[model samples]
Target: MTTPQALVLGIVQALTEFLPVSSSAHLVIMQDYLGFKNPLLLFDVILHAATLGALLVYFRKDIGKIILSLVRLKEKSDEEMLNRKIFYFILVGTIPTLALGLVLNQWIKAMFTSVTFTSLMLLVTGALLWISKRRADSERGIEEMKTTDAFLIGIMQGVAIIPGISRSGATMSTGLLRGIKKELAFRYSFLLSIPAIIGALGLQLREALLEQTLPSHPFPWIGGVLAAAIIGYISLVLFRKIILRKKLHIFAYYCWTIGTISLIIRLAT
Candidate 1:
């Protein structure tokens, strides 16, 4: 890919990755229409790694607390116990996500190539976001979260494996529908993505190694990675603010608008 194309792709990935929008949908649309190509999966892996790094840096403090709590799991304090439970909740959430992803792996991969189908899925995502706005006020915290809630949210995350289905949006909407407080739901959704993103990166890395596809020019790829990481961090911060302000449904209108336009284009072509 050219430097400008790489940079644009990187920005799209970072901006949509953590937002209530599907990064995969945006990437696929760009590739299909703009004819940008990155062989051997190098560009994809780099971008994913960058976003993963962003997540790690943003949640470093929470990760440290979770690790410390695990090390001293025998403690009797309420705070310590709550931390331990949060750690386990993440694990529990990953179980269903991994299971569903594995079973639907090929099916999900197929969806990535179809802009028309992805556009339809984007409509589904928009509907979910709109519905989330109607949920009653919730004040429950991590202390009151149950394994079932995590599992259900995980199922939503798993379903988001399909192209155009926003992973963050689905999981957060499920959490809110389950009556989870907005802040906690927002925090947990991103936290839950850590394992999912890592697993995806590992798989992509293995594919790249097997294909042995190396880029002749590495500078643009490096630039892409930096752009993705920096933009991803900013997107995360902005998403948190939007969720806290109870205005997440604002994204619903964007999704619906894009989905309709995409559908019309697909039909015309």
Candidate 2:
């Protein structure tokens, strides 16, 4: 690939990594557009690691507080108690997704081969967000939540592994449907992305190392990782504000518009 092609791929990965759109789905579409095959999966791992670093850096202070409180849960200290509860909620919320992912990771990738499937799944995401926004109360906070609620949200995350199903979008929709306020729901969604991405990248990284056949130049790889990290951080903060104040119903509109147009273009061409 030309340096220009590599640069474009980097930009696409950066932009879609945090947007409600599925990054891998867009990457696959764009790769098909360019007629590129045998993509260096190492690059995929690098981009993912960069985005994970961005999240950890962005949430550093909150992560620290959560960690300390979780450690002090043995005392059952009153103030520490709430934070510990949230900590447990996160763990419980991650389990279903992780377990399901382990069971079906290979099969799920096969189902993603059809562009139409991806395009249709994008519509599903839009519909889900639309229904969730309208149906949700948007007033409840974390304290009101139960363990069963968190586990149910985890199942929602598991279903989001389909191509074009936005991981953050699905988790947030689950939280909203469970009566959590938009901002806190968005916060938990972002928090959950950390663990999901880490597990995925680790698995992919191992595969890439063992199976990589082509070697990529160091400079483009470095450039892509750096740009993805900065862009991912900006996307998180910007979209987060949008999620909190505005109705996410509009994002559904965008997704449907884009997905429908893409499907039409593909059929026509």
Candidate 3:
């Protein structure tokens, strides 16, 4: 890949990864059009790592509290207990997600090659976002969340593994449907993504190691990672504000527009 191509891919990954738009769909389309023959697996692993770093940095305080609570698990202050509970909620949410992802891995991979299918999934994502806009306002926080809520949201996350189904969009929509406050829903969605992204990277890392493939353009890969991390952090901050303002549904229009265009292209071709 060329430097410009790498930078463009990095920007797309960062912008769409946290947005209601699907990053995987954009990457697949871009890769196909650009005719990139490099080891995309390694490149994608690095790009995801960069976004993972952004997530950690953005949620450092929450993560720190979770870690501290775990470290002092037996001390049991009221606040520490609350933190522990929240941590467990995250763990509970990840269970169904991991299970469903493993089961659907091959199906998801196959869908990546079908732009028409991905385009249709984007329409589904847009519909979910639009539906979320009609949900009544909520004030529930992480402490108020139930196990069933977590599991259901996890299932949404798992389903988002399909190309063009935004992970952040699906989880946030599910959270809203479950009566989570908008800001809290957004926060938890990204927080939940930490484990999901890590697990994905771990699996990809193992695959890359086994394949013994490396990027042909190492400098471009490094540039892509840096670009992704920087842009991802900015996007995360902006998304928080958008969610707080209850403007998340605005992204639905974009998804619908893109999906329509993609469908047209597929039909014409």
Tens-digit per-residue lDDT, 1-269, candidate 1: 78888888899889989999888888877777766543325567778889999999999988888889888868878878877888788999999999999998888766777889988888999999999998737677897888899999999999998989999999999999888999899889989999999998888788777776667888888888899999999999999999988888888998899888998998998
Total clashes for model 2: 0
For candidate 1, list the clashing residue pairs, or say none. Answer: none
**Residue-wise C-alpha lDDT for candidate 3, range 37-95, written one tens digit per residue:** 44376677778899899889999999998899999878878889878887887899999
Q: In candidate 2, where is summed lDDT lowest over 10 consecutive residues?
A: 213-222
Superior candidate under TM-score, 1 versus 3: 1
Backbone clashes in model 2, listed as residue pairs: none
Best by TM-score: 1
Stretches of candidate 1 above 4 Å error? 37-40
- Judged by TM-score relative to the true structure, which candidate is superior, 1 or 2? 1
RMSD of 3: 1.6
| CA lDDT scores, all candidates in order | 0.87, 0.77, 0.87
Model 2: residues with Cα > 4 Å off, grouped in runs: 74-79, 135-137, 213-216
* Tens-place lDDT digits, model 2, residues 77-180: 76577677777888998899899888879977675555677777888888887878674557877778888878887887787778778777777777888888
Q: How do all the candidates rank in terms of TM-score, highest first?
A: 1, 3, 2
